[model samples]
Target: MAIPVTAIFDIGKTNKKFFLFDENLRELHHEYFKLTPTLDDDGFECDDIYVLCNWIQNTVRKITSSGEYQLKRLNFSTYGATLVHLDADGKPVTPLYNYLKPFPDDICDQFYKQYPQDEHNLHTASPALGMLNAGLQLYWLKYTKPQVFQRIRYTLHFPQYLSYLFTGQLVSEPTSIGCHTKLWDFSRNRYHDWVYTEKIDHLLPEIVPASKTFQTIIGGHAVKVGVGIHDSSSALAAYMMRTQEPFALISTGTWSITLNPYTKESLTRDELNRDCLNFLTIEGKPVKASRLFLGHELDHHLRILNDIFHKEARYYKQIKLQDSFLKKIHNHELTPSFYPATIANPLLSQDVFSSDNWKPNNFESYEEAYHHLIWGLTLLQVASARLALGNSDVKKIYIDGGFIDNDIFIKLLQYYLPNYTIEVSHMPLGSAHGAAMIMQGKQVELVV
Candidate 1:
């Protein structure tokens, strides 16, 4: 008898990964592949959906025919803020538009002008993120590209679309819909009024729980396929399962998202302006989340510093957390000298951090300068994390992903959030693991 296994496709903006886990949920094999993106109709670079679809189908056939392990289940965890519009015949009507594609300013201004209430944002728990709001993408299509909009019969978030390819199920999950898509009304537990007013909700499929699964045939083998989940919410689900205490998670990557699922406070306008939003759990409960482009900023600054300091790439990885450096930063004896006034804003621009300002002669050593950068970022992180925490009594803070290896980032976070117990999570479970776990009827308990 072969070992029973589950396969998970963890798709990101850049890397696409496939993982197989045994009956006990231990990772057995993993493969990482990068897909080349193609330009959208607007010439903005976007995912080549045809390539992705073929890769997924080919991988499934290859796995099921191997006869090494019995493929029992399949699921997906992909980035949010992207949608796939389907024609009446269930074919893609438009390119998989990149979330980073700049939404037209005219369209954005027009939207707010028509719906001037700040309460609109609060109710949906979605800020003015332009193209990042999937619902706005539909709105953009309706007004700007009415021809394309007219041909659409259904709209599916990226993850569910991937699931649809195999299961033939057209459904939406809360985790994807609730990810600052400007579609879900978090307060009312339904589509926002604007969604109906615009008739964009008419294109969306029936809502389903993230864990909902359907039996399907693949390469002559029977498999259970999940409805799929948003990557960030999927990650939080992993931590939610291991601990029973009231805790907060800082999932660090290109974006450092601090999530507090326990906060009871209502979403506020001020929080929206400060880049705070809500992500939904698998069961459709809102999780307060605050985000920062921390990793992007950190890497951007590091590249400039590396050239100035004449150090090899990743030299900052060798630097340890120095108490003397940390103390001066904490005491304000040494300010975040390298940062400009625009540091107050979480959004980044080329002019905000000019490489000319980062002179090597200004610092005693690379370590000192690096520590200052981490200190500054940690301060911002503390502030962002606090927004997610709000009035919640969560005392435990778990740091996961890229920043886990950065000693300075971890220590500085600990210094700033002293009241909370901050620790690095070594758990192997990530978004992919969480998606697989969901298919097994597992629920993450948060009661302490």
Candidate 2:
């Protein structure tokens, strides 16, 4: 008998990736494809459902027929805050709306007026973050696009939608439902009453546990399809399998999110305003997390330096600026106290002058100039991480993602956060690996 293999469809906004892992959670093969957005009849930007559906079908067929591996189970881990509407026939009735689409202003006003900001915040345990709140998207469609809304038979979160593509079943999983979607009542541990009160409960698919499994046959192979999980939560699951002690994870990428799985306290308004939010674990528990736009800012500043000095940004090596230069840049008139610690503002001239902005006017080497830039970026990241730490008893900070490869950034972070022991995670495929691990009732061994 052949060993059982699990296939994971890890879907992101830009890339749709597939991975096949054996029963021991070892990756066998992986493939990825980019998805293009298509305009709907009204010229609104939406995902090409047909393209995604066809790709998934073709990939599954090809993988199952390879004869190199026997497929036994399948699972999905995808980005959150997007939904797909299915018709009575289990077919998508409308274009998968992009979460990037703006929410209507009138609806926002009406929603706040009806529920009051504080009441709604307390009820949902979610901050009002423009389009990031998936529940608001449903409200937008109901009020602004009634025609499309009326035709919907069921709505599934993005990960669940991917699972539905293969299982031919519409089910909502906890990980997707519990994201900052404002759909689930975290305090009550059930769907919010507004779902039924607003008559939109019919749109929701049947709820299922994240670890629940369903049987499906594909290409003469019997496969167990597990309910989907959110990518962040999946990553956490993979990490938890390796460690039993309380620890915090800094998942770095476009956004550096510091997650404290042990912090179960409800978020206050100030924390929400600072970009802190709750994530639902695969087991349907709230995981407190705070996000910082460090990666975005770093790239922005690097590009600005590249343009100004006509040099590509070097990230791997450490750059140390002279004490005099650092002092001068810190005291420079261009530096603003309120300069947002985010990469949203790229123009160095508009914010603070770092080593990146230091031309040969007085500096001796390019290394010095680069060091200044690193100093500023590192300082911002440290401050952001401290804010995310809050009052949580985070003993060890596990850094993962692109920044872990940068020695200069890590060293600077180590210097600033001297109180906590910093460790870089070796897990390469975190979220996808976590999804695969959860399916087999196994855990990832932590590498120190």
Candidate 3:
């Protein structure tokens, strides 16, 4: 007999994954792929939606026909701050623009001037992220490409778009809407006023709970298809289901995000300025979050250091935190902070470290310099994490993703947050697992 299973598509910016889990949520199969991105009309790189769509359809057909498992359900967990615009006949009308693509400064300046208080609007929980705020993408399109915008009958967040390809259903969910997209008004619990004002709300599909699914027939089999979820929220859902206590999650990747689902305090403007925002759970409750460009900063500086120190790319992975090195930093024996004490800035900058930004004379060895880098980032991370923590009496912090394997990063975090229990999460599959759980209607309520 074929084992009953659920199929989940966990799509990240660089890695697109497909996974199968048996009835007991045990992994049955997993496939990973790296699709080459295509360029937008203006030559900016973006996801090739057609290529991704074909891969999904082809993968499903191959698996369903394999007979190794019964594909009972289908769902998706994808990166947020991206959208796919569809025409009236449900055909894509534009490229899947990269979230990092620059949003014109003039338009951004004009937007704030119009909605003077929006920058500090806690109700939206969106910072001035320009293109990173997906709603502004629609605004940019409407103003710059009115002809293309006119053709857009609907716009679905990346995850929902993937779900729509299979289920043929048009819908939205809280996880995507509330992920610093600037579309959701958390206080009002509806679309933001700017959305309605710009008439961008019309292009958005109907809103649905993240756990809601549609009964569909796929490849001659009945399937429960989820509306889909943002990757971060999906990962948090996995922890919420198992962990009974209130805690913060430091989900690291290109961006290191500290998430606190238990914070009761409202997001202050000061917090917003410090890069703190809120993400919604699958249930539409706000989860306070703080962001830091950790991985990006580390990668950038590591390249410079590798050249200066004549070390391999992966050398830093083996470096561990040394107490004596940390003590020098704490005792002010190390003159001039390598990275700025500013929590909102990147992990490392030349501004405060040395005159030319980087000076080889600052350190005797590559390992010593690496230790300083980690310590500096950890100092900023402590502040960022505290912003998310608020007054919540959370005693545990779970660090997940790429940095979990970085000993220096993990150790420094533990040292800085001595009052809390710091743990490295082994759940790299948390997002995929969480997507499956939502499809199974097994979402557990998390009490703060």
Candidate 4:
């Protein structure tokens, strides 16, 4: 007799991981690896498609052939805002282009002008993210990389492409397509009309429920493979599956995303401008979401802190959150200008960063200055989280992801969201857990 376990591959821009989960969703074994990226045919940097595919096959083959455990199921959870173009031979015809690649301004301008942005963007519940919208990548390819576009017999989001590798089946899952991709018309509950107008919809494979799985033959054994899900939705799925009531999940990482499954109204123009959008649940339900570059900003701010204070990197680990500082934050007495105006990124405007009179020079110590910066950050976080809290019944806010371990951050969040129940969820591999959760059933059970 062999031990049975579910195998999951969680793919991200910087890390590729494989995990084995026992029957109760506990991690049995895991492995992490990094594959160096290479330039595409156009000489632009991108993930090497062949190398990634080869690694996936060889690793899974080795795992199953070892006889340590029986591979009961297979699933994938990957970052969004990426597409994989496959030719008629069911193989990649183009590089797995980076979402951050510079999209031509003219191409973006043309796309907005061709469609009524106020109506279309609001209806789609997506912001004007240019190529970051993913669907816009098709339009860019159509006009800029016509040869590559012509060779595409099918276009699959990154997660689906990974699933196709094992199941040899292509699918369009709502959780992946409904992310701020600008492809699905939330109001219409299908691909936007412009997709048909441009005939791009033809290349899309059939839309399948994110909860659906199919049989696949691998390593001379039958396997259950999921259709794939967007990483955000997959992470949300774990909470959604376990909880039986309305709640908001604030996932903090490079980007801090707040997802609310109970929002009642459609997104307005203001929400879109503020980076508020909709994410389809694993059950194909709309989840109001808002994003902020909280963690990234924290990193950049810390780097500057290290340089200014002449301290070692990651010195934050040594400093402890003080009760006095927490009280100052609670009373709104810790007003100070931090994050020099020169450090402004696209995520948050620095015009509102207040006066720079309280720079590091003003503080007696680096620890005090860093705490003040976080105090200001908490205020911004409350505002960002509120965007996703619109018209929802959620009273409990669950904080998870990279920053959950920060006692000061959690304390600040609790202070700000005093009206809501705040709790820190130590589980960080939410996306992987979610992929496994969706494996046992097709339609997710929603608590009324």
Candidate 5:
């Protein structure tokens, strides 16, 4: 008998990736596609819904029809805080609004007044963020785009929307609902009263367990489909399944988010100002998380360095740094502080690094220059990671994603976080893989 295979659609803003995992949660084969943007009737840039639906349908068919593998199930893991509004016929009334589009300032102010910013933050377990908070998107549409909002029958988070395309079910997963949406009341474990107060309750789908299986017949194959999960929560699931002990995870990509699963503390005013957020696990428990645009900053500075030195930015392999250069950086006394004034664009600058001078002198090799640049980045990452740790006792720091591929970045992180054991994750397709694991109804060893 052939091993059972599960397919997953892992959707991101820039990339739509597909993965096939066998019964053991090993990746069998994977492919990725990019989404093209189309303007809606109102001339607002939006995701091409038809293209995505078609892609899902064709992909499912392709997987089932392939005689090489025994297809048994399917699931989805996607970026959070974006939703799709559907009509009575289950057709989208408008293009899927891009979350990157800014929410109106006045509307947010109105929400703050009614709920009180601090209380609302406490209730939702999510600090207020403009468009990133999915609930504000609904408010924006209801008040500003009244006509469009009225036509909506259901508002499904992006992940559930994809699952709905496959199973014809309208349900909410805990992870997606609890993410900075302002829709969920984490303390109460239900939708906030404001959902009905604003008459937007009908927009939300019925809540479903992330691990719930929705069975369907595709291409004459009986496949079990999952409700879908938030990308971050899914990533956490993958990590949790791998380890049985308490640990903190730093998932790096376009945005580097540090997540501490053990910390159940509420957000403070100061923490909120630093962009700290509380996310719900797939099981509906709060996971303390803070984000830094470390990847974005690294990319930006790399570009700046490349432009200035007229050389391509490459990885700095291990090489002996001159004692003099090391002494200069180490001996220079610098106080650790959050100097917001030095930040020209805090959102664009992922690394909290400030220096009077950063000119590169002629080094023996490119490795020396690379070390200097990465050392600066590592310092910022370490500080940001500490903020995420908060009052928790994290014994191990699990580093995952693209940062694991960078040797210098990992080494620097190891150097700074010497108190904790730094273990690099070996999981492939972490988010999608975790979603599949949830559907499989089993746990596997976490080999890092």
Candidate 6:
């Protein structure tokens, strides 16, 4: 007999993954692929929309028609800060623009002049992030590519666009709209005034509930298709489901994000200035969050360290928890020297790390030097996490994603945040599992 399964497409910046989960959500099978990006008309590299779209179609057809497993449902969780523009006839009008693609400085300056700094940004809970503010892409299009913009029928966030490929439905959900995109006004619970005032809202499709799903027949079987969700918000779903108490999730990958959903404070200018922003859950509530480029910075630091230490780059993995080093820190014997360079967060300056920037000359061995590196990195991590942790009584912190494997990093985190119970998350399939779970349950209410 064939097994009944649900498929989830979990797409992040570096990898695209497909996973099959059984009735109980145990992963039965999984595969990953990397799409070779193509250059857009403006010479900036972007996702090969046509190739990616074709890949999605071919993959789904193979799965549905295979008949080895009953395909009961499907959903997507994709990175935010991307858009797929479609024309009147429901075809892509331009390349899927890369979020990191530079917005012209002159144009960006003009945008701020119109919207202004605190006046417009504070209301949306969005920080000034150049092209990272996905909504600004609309203005970039209207002003620079009017001919291409004029033909647009609907502009879909990438996840919804992926869902549309299967069900032919256009949707806007809070998870994508609320992701520092400068599109949503959290207080009013809708598009920001600038979006409507500028008439950029016209290009947007009607928003569907994040929980909404469509039933469709495919390959002689009926399937439930979800409305799609942003990857970060979707990743938080599984944690939100299982944990009964208030907690913070430090989801680490290319970026290390500290998310606290229990906070009552509205984002202040000070918080926003430190790269602290808000993300909406699938249910449309704020997940007060902070960001650090610690993951990427670790890689960069390792490359430099390997060159200096004359060892294989992966040496850190061999070092277990440094009990002797911990004693030094605990006894105030290690006057830690800091390294100034860390990965840059767009919303904040590097000045926060400079005060303690000490040299690595004092270390006798690579292990000692590595400990120093982590100590400096932890300082930045703490600052980012504190943005969301302010005045909250969250007694537990759940560290998820890649950094959970780093004992040194986790131990430093525990030492720094001794007031909280720190534990590594057991679930690596957070985003995919979260996307699938939302299909069966009632909407989760945020903790007050």
Number of the predicted model whose lDDT against the real structure is largest: 1
Better of 2 and 3 by TM-score: 3
TM-score of 2: 0.84
Candidate 3, residues 118-235: lDDT per residue as tens digits?
A: 5436778967887889888998998899999999999999999999988888998888988888888888778878888888888888877888888888878998988889988888
Ranking by lDDT: 1, 3, 4, 6, 5, 2
Worst 10 residues of 6 by lDDT: 346-355
Candidate closer to the true structure by TM-score (higher is better), 5 or 6: 6
Clashes of each: 0, 1, 0, 0, 1, 1
Q: Which stretches of candidate 1 lie over 4 Å from their true place?
A: 340-361, 443-448
Candidate 5 displacement at residue 31 in angstroms? 1.6
Q: Give all candidates' CA lDDT scores.
A: 0.84, 0.72, 0.82, 0.81, 0.76, 0.81
Instruction: Quote each prediction's TM-score.
Output: 0.92, 0.84, 0.92, 0.92, 0.87, 0.92
Model 4 per-residue lDDT tens digits across residues 1-448: 6778888888866678888888778889889878898987767788887898888889889878989888878999988899999998987888888876778999988888899788889878998876679999899899988998899999999999999998888788888888889998888777889999999998999887787788988888898988888887888988977889889999777667899988898888878888889988876778899987787678777887788888898788767689988776568686656643322333443434556564665678888878877766676677789889986788999887778777777887887788999878876477888898888563653211
lDDT of 6 by residue, 1-448 (tens): 7788888898877678898888888888888878999999999998898888787778778888886888888888888889888987889898988887988988888888988889677888877887779999988898888998898889999999988988899888888988889888887877888888778888898876677888888787898988788887887777888878999888877777788889988999878878888888877888898877777788877887787788897788887667998898889786646654654453453544444445555568788888888877776787788788889989898887777888888888888888899878767467788888877644644221
lDDT of 2 by residue, 1-448 (tens): 5556888988765557899888778777899888888986567797798998798889889878887778888898887888888877878777777766767788989888876877676667777765678978788778878988888888888888878877888888777876779887767877778777788888887776777777899889888887788887787778887789888888776667677788747777766655677777766677787666667666765675566566755742455434564455447523422234444323322323333433333434455545655666666666556555677787798888667877667776776688999988776457788888878864222110
Across 45-107, the per-residue lDDT of candidate 1 in tens digits comes to 999999998998899888898888889999999988999999999999999999889999899
Off by over 4 Å in 2: 1-3, 40-47, 298-380, 442-448
Give the alpha carbon lDDT tens digit for every residue of 1-448 in model 5. Answer: 5567988998866568899888888888899887789987657787788998899889888878877777888889988888888988998877777766767889989888888888888777776777789988888888888998889999899989888887899988788987788888877878888888999987787776787888888888888888888887888888887688898889876667788889857777667666677877777778888776666666665665566556756633334444554455567744222222222335323445454355544444455555666676677677677877987878898877767788768866886787999989877757887888888885332110
Candidate 5 Cα outliers beyond 4 Å, as residue runs? 1-3, 39-46, 309-329, 333-352, 355-373, 442-448
Overall local distance difference test of candidate 5? 0.76
Candidate 2 has which clashing residue pairs, if any?
A: 297-343
Where does model 3 exceed 4 Å of error? 118-120, 327-332, 335-337, 340-357, 360-362, 443-448
Residue pairs with clashing backbones, model 4: none
